[model samples]
Target: MHVPDGFINAPVSVAAGAVAATAVAVSLRGARRELDERTAPLAGLVAAFIFAVQMLNFPVAAGTSGHLLGGALAAILVGPYTGVLCVSVVLLMQGILFADGGLTALGVNITNMAVVTVVVAYAVFRGLLRLLPAGRRSVTVAAFAGALLSVPGAAVMFTLFYALGGTTDVPIGKVFTAMTGVHVLIGVGEAVITAATVGAVIAVRPDLVHGARGLAVPLKLRVDGRLVDAPAAPAAPVPAAARSTRPLWISGLVTALVLAGFVSYYASSSPDGLEKVAADQGIDAKAREHAAADSPLADYSVKDVSDARLSGGLAGIIGVGGTVVVGTGVFWAVRRRRADDLTAAATAAPSAH
Candidate 1:
């Protein structure tokens, strides 16, 4: 659902841009509470992982394909605010480097893909968690349900935007029906990927999964016909080396590289859900060329690279590397700001006393 230029009129596009900017600003503040020393680096890896997985588009219909939107997966693994930022970073990178999404219509893309998906999916996920059994499986289940819904939610949002500012005169009802119908099929793919990824992370390091935290029920004991909380067991001492997140980080980075560099070559070549719908419904009648189309890495192909495989592989690797570096720097700065704020508050509290 990378909205290209000229799809939306200038007035609506500017309004969408303002909305995206405000959402990003709010998310930056919220992320200060979500990111800390432990999760900040993990958040960066999550962005890179999402970027890589998105490259492996799976067939949804005969001629339509779908890929991971990453909103539900990222929110479940990290937090919603950070999740929005992660997808935004990927979109930004794709727009400027890969010429995938339109630079002019970036705000529209972010509003639909980042803001709407994250907001809706996280709400559904947390709401389900309250009703479902408290366990790792429940987290995975809720993630699937949330992801399933988020795709359609985004489709609806896009339809509304098109209704207001669509360049063509396609019927609103038809656009809505087609967009929602196709995206629902695409949502199935999103759900499976989100659930599997969430389940895997919960299995290895439940502590790192934000949604899986606090799911462990405390032990109970019955004494004298009355139930009481059992004494907490002392945690086994972990070696300093074992406690380091370096291994997990390295493993995640390697996995992203493998998927983007090689596995993506086998992904379906068909157009994705949005592209298919646009072409079929005449939504792209006025679509303009991407500004970055002349870039060396445009269209995921490296300039002067003779081998198609090698060129695509190099571009993927570069994208993953650049995303990780930029994302980590952004998150690290946010984390440091939080720490500084805490220190300042502590200093002022003593002076007030």
Candidate 2:
């Protein structure tokens, strides 16, 4: 959830900021191992896709709506470290550009929506994979379960944060109950979207699915009087057509544009799980205005644009474009840094004269 300013006291907010910053720093190092030439670009696409899908909020209850938190989907597609970075990028773009989340509470949003969701979802997913059958289908199943739980897990984390640094004197127990209850319903939507997206990617390019890797069971062969493992066969050369990610990337970008630019117009006009709970529980009593509330693209609408559809559409397109550009730049820089590190290490090696 996008925690706005004033919900948490300044002290806890700053502490959460430190936590979020540390998580991002750690993820930068961890993502180096996860992102390669093939997956680095996909990581950027994943962030953009998450940003697009979040615009299409679906109705969860009569007056409550939910959108993709995207932790499980990103983790399943890329690795967890990269997954955290992906969601963080989307949150960053939304906060600074769209004013969807508060700048002062950026750390709270990142901690709950990025760190908590990614860690919980990926942990559940990996645990399920270890216990269940190793197959594409199992990956989808685990993804659903992982996503289903991550939403409530984030809710719980937010509740705890609020309990510690809540601006108002609301009942912590009541808030926790409401937050978890609504988010559990929201989690259903998260699970379906995550499973479908993961299934689609697994179908097209299983190699690109970080969670589905190493799923090919090894073969056993009968030898003379003893059983032995079969030697691994060399991989066949893939044609340029099959090897290229251009098609997938193009299709995904187009789909994101369509969703954000057009389909988002029909999304439910209701409060999301967090907003509903906050309003109901008086958590918004002290909520402060967003610092960028007067920004041209604030509130997901372009400034001075009379047409609702036009204003929203332009804002969505701009958000998607900004997220893609920033995400790609970050991922490419990380990838380049890795390559540079390797080159420097090789150069520093001792000469064996």
Candidate 3:
């Protein structure tokens, strides 16, 4: 949910911003391990894909809709640290360029939408995978369950945040019930999207899936007297260029363009889960104006464009292009920074070096 400005007070907003800053700082360091040549390329695509998928708000109830939160999918496809960066990139682009989420509430949105979902989803996913069979199918199954649960996890966190710093005096219990109930259905959609997407990618190129690494079960052989562990297969060769390739990423980006540029105009014209709940509970009374409400890109349409199809199509293309450029820049900078740090470290080494 893109929490607007007035939902939470100044103190809560500032506190959440600080938390987001700290988390991003930590993720920058952690991303080095997760963002090698292979994962870094996919990371940018993941961000772009999340942005595109979010544009298509699927109907969940009669008057409400929901879309991918994307934290779990990003984390599972890449890694947790890069996943954080990926969601943050999407949030940043949406806020600054599209005005989809509020600037003042950026920190809260990141913490709740990016951090909470990835952490919760990955933890549950890893646990489930551990308990299940170690196969591609099992991975897909675990991904489905993980995506199913992560949405409710985020709703719980959001409810807690509102309970703590809510601007209005609403019933805490009722809010929790409403948020969790709607999001549970939303989670089912998330699960299906996640499982199907992951399964498809792994089927094509399991090597590209960061979570699928090291999934090959070891070989067993019969020895002279008894069964014995066979030597592991030789580590596959890493084509210097192939390591960074991302066919799934290219496919995903193309699909995102098609969906957003052409398909999003037809998406349900209904309030999303959060908006519906807020309106029903009278919690939206305090909703503040977006800081960039006047931006040409706000409301997902181009300025002075009379044709509905033309305006919306241009907006979607702008959004998709902008998100891809911004996301790629952010991730590339992160990767460059890592490489620079390593080079400096290598240079600083003394006689042993």
Better of 1 and 2 by TM-score: 1
lDDT of 2: 0.92
Which one wins by lDDT: 1 or 2?
1
TM-score of each: 0.97, 0.96, 0.94
| Candidate 1 lDDT by residue in tens digits, 1-353 | 88899899998999999999999999999999999898999999999999999999999899999888889988888899999999999999999999988898999999999999999899999999999989999999999999999999999999999999999999999999999999999899999999999998888788889998889888889999998999999999978766677888999999999999999888899999999999999999999999999999998889999998999889999999999999999999999999999999998998896
Q: Clashes in each model (backbone N, CA, C under 3 Å)?
A: 0, 0, 0
Error of 3 at 104 (Å): 1.1
What is the alpha-carbon RMSD of candidate 1 to the true structure? 1.2
Clashing pairs in 3: none
Could you tell me how far off, in angstroms, the CA of residue 226 lies in candidate 2 after the best superposition? 10
Residue 296 of model 2: what lDDT?
A: 95
Question: Per-residue lDDT for 1-353 in model 2, tens only?
Answer: 78888899999999999999999999999888888888888899999999999999999998999999998888889889899999999999999888888887889999899899999999999999999987999999999999999999999999999999999989999999999999999999999999999999989999889999999977889889777889999999999887788888889888998889999999999999999999998999999999988899999999999999999998889888888889988998888888898888888786633
In terms of lDDT, the best-performing candidate is: 1
Q: What is the C-alpha RMSD of each candidate to the true structure, in Å?
A: 1.2, 1.8, 2.0
